[model samples]
Target: MTLPLNPQRVSVDSISKIKELSGENIKACMQCGTCTVACPMAEEMDFFPRKVMHFSQFGMLSRMEDINSYWKCASCHSCSVRCPRGIDIAKVMESLRLLVLRTNKNYIEPSQIPKEKLKEYPGIMMVAGFRKLTS
Candidate 1:
């Protein structure tokens, strides 16, 4: 599927778990906005919860940067927990963020991590890096 932006041009690497950890079947989303209402950061987003899914489904990642909703998710999991579709919305966000990070990019302004701290948080990075489910 060649999207307008041509996600193939974007090259979503580093997110080996794109189809694993998230497990958020976009087909299940009905754009009901329940996830938005349940999201703690919906009020501060450029696009509501449903929009995020739309963007991801279409691979229009730039929309995520235009809004703070992605970062605001806070991984509260309220949306996923309450979703009638049982989609893992928070994990979806993480996958989006992970893919974005892969292309040497970020949705947040002034995005940077202190290199000196990489070794300090080895365990945290380890878990985040190997999030893929093999079985």
Candidate 2:
């Protein structure tokens, strides 16, 4: 049986929380795609930075819940540097991560990771991932 797609509702509170945390005007994004073009991790993201901003502007939190775009963000500030409206897209991504973490849900369980994989990954990468993915 085919399942019907239900559109996710917008949450004004989510939008406000993002603005409060990021201190950036998400509505300032004009869908210019500059952030997406400038993102080195865009290819790895399920949604491009521009689309993430678009969803964020509308407060589509449910739609964002399962996406890996924000988690894939490197926080490298490349998008922030290239934005025409001076909107720090990286901050927005960070806010999304914060929202998820506030619910006490971790994107990845540190304990579940294999010891060999942890040893293979660089310490800086592990540190960054823990900061972003863990509560």
TM-score of each: 0.61, 0.90
As for candidate 2, its clashing pairs are none
lDDT of 1 by residue, 1-135 (tens): 011233443324312234454766665677887888898888887788888876665545444554566656678899998888888889887766555555555343222446665566677654543342110
User: Against the true structure, candidate 1 has what lDDT?
Assistant: 0.62
lDDT by residue (tens digit), candidate 2, 1-135:
110122257877777888998999998889999999999999999999999999889888777868899888999999999999999999999988887788688888999999999989999989988988898
Best by lDDT: 2
Q: Candidate 2 deviates by what RMSD? A: 4.4
Query: Which candidate number has the best TM-score?
Result: 2
- Candidate 1 clashes: the total is 0
